[model samples]
Target: MTPLGTAVTAGTERAWIEFRRGFTNATDLGFYVVMSVVVFAILWFNRDTVVQVPGYELPSATYALPSFVGGLIAFLSVLGVAYALAMEREDGTLLRAKSLPHGMTGYVVGQVLRTTLETIAGLTLALVPAMLFIDGILVDGVGGLVWLPAILVLGLLATLPIGVVIGAVVRSVRQVNTWGSLPLFALIWASGIFVPTIALPQWARVVGQLFPVYWLGLGTRAVLLPDEAAALEIGGSWRPGWTVAVLVAWAVAGVLVAVPILKRMAARESGSAIAERRERALQRTY
Candidate 1:
């Protein structure tokens, strides 16, 4: 086989192995189960409360549901990947990757596949049941079925590389929560995940719009809600074209930045550096 083909085959195997290991790990499994329950509980509590959305006969959960799903997509793509990368780096996983032929290539491919599948799994666990049981959540029917998956894939591309860059730059696993996860929660809150952009102050809405979280939520809403529901959105339209444009731009820019940054990070992964990190971790533990 060609060297490229060999690498692709190795990467695919690595991705599958990693995915299986992750799902089977006790901690990871527990976290998934707990998060699934939390998500369903939130949806259940909100199921009965109806909000007045213009041109929509259903409750507010119709809008909230898509936004919630979109927010989870953004969170998983960014903070989830970043946390995993940081932990791997501290534990010498990156160093091991650097030692093998074309290991970085395979590792990156595995990571991308892992995170993408994880995001889809999250949606399946949390959002699919809501759509099936809840009334008025997905009113756009066949069109939504097509566009929702498209936007989700685009959202993953746009946000996943940002996480890669963050992981390459973060100093330690502990720092991921501080610099990556915390700020993501802040973005989710401001991005109109739980509220309409129209209800936010003008400046606040502008600030939210600067990030991908808002756009992801907006795109999801566009796919799931009725046309008249666009009246509730800022600019009174879904702006699907602009959503795709911005997400694509982010994906391109993030790839350009992440490649160089990841290269540098990989280059710096020496045995001594890994030992020092291990020593520091031991010291903190004792």
Candidate 2:
């Protein structure tokens, strides 16, 4: 390996160690376990009500579960990574990492990888209950099953750069939490997660189309629902091809914007400056 590659690898290893420590410390595993049970319970209790909608026939709960879980995973994963970045900035840890070889790229890669793994695990846990309780939810044909993982990976890739950008720009944990919640809610609402985009007002539909969430939901619905169901109209006319293209475009655009921002953030994160700020804060408190 080239020296840069070696340094990147070593930095990735260190980042992984830190990630594991934080993951365990946060007891995220336990959170996922409890959440899975709760989500299944909700689905079970509401299945009859959910099926009552006219002209809305679903295959199995298992097939429907992944998109819901995936949406949630995407939101939380991005928020978590952003929060981590803000904390690292405050703690001077990011500055320390910068002093190491290939530290910036390796640290960024490790965070993205760790966050992606967490999202996958959470989504998988969500699917188990969906399979057990929601009948006819699994992929209908062998073809769908074979392609499911590939689609999911693409979906994950689509969300990663947005997460990185959120992480890079937010100045504080409080700001991240407050501002982040707005987009999360907006995306979920606009994406037709609870209500079909067709049902939304014209202005809302116009606004929703500008975001990746709409495309993500549209692509997911195309994959999970029957062709006839997918044929249902949205934002005037329904087109799966347009949905896929839009989502891919969003993902590409997000990456293009995030990389330079991350580099800029890294350049600005000086250990001495962070330490001085902390000292001043401490003095003011005393």
Model 1 RMSD to the real structure?
Answer: 1.7
Clashing pairs in 2: 60-136, 60-137, 62-137, 63-137
- Candidate 2 lDDT over residue span 117-205, tens digit each: 66766777766656666654445688667556555666666777777787778766667866676787777776666555666777877
lDDT, candidate 2, at 94: 83
lDDT of 1 by residue, 1-286 (tens): 8755676678788778877887889998787778778877887888777766665555666768889888999988897779878988988888887777778887888788889888888778777777766765554668778888888988999899989988989989888888888888888888889887888878878888888788899999888776777877888999999998888888899899998999999999988998899899899999
| Location of the lowest summed lDDT over 10 successive residues in candidate 1 | 51-60
What lDDT does model 2 reach?
0.68
Give the least accurate 10-residue stretch of model 2, judged by summed lDDT: 51-60
Could you report the Cα RMSD, in angstroms, for every candidate shown?
1.7, 3.1
The best candidate by lDDT is: 1
TM-score of 1: 0.94
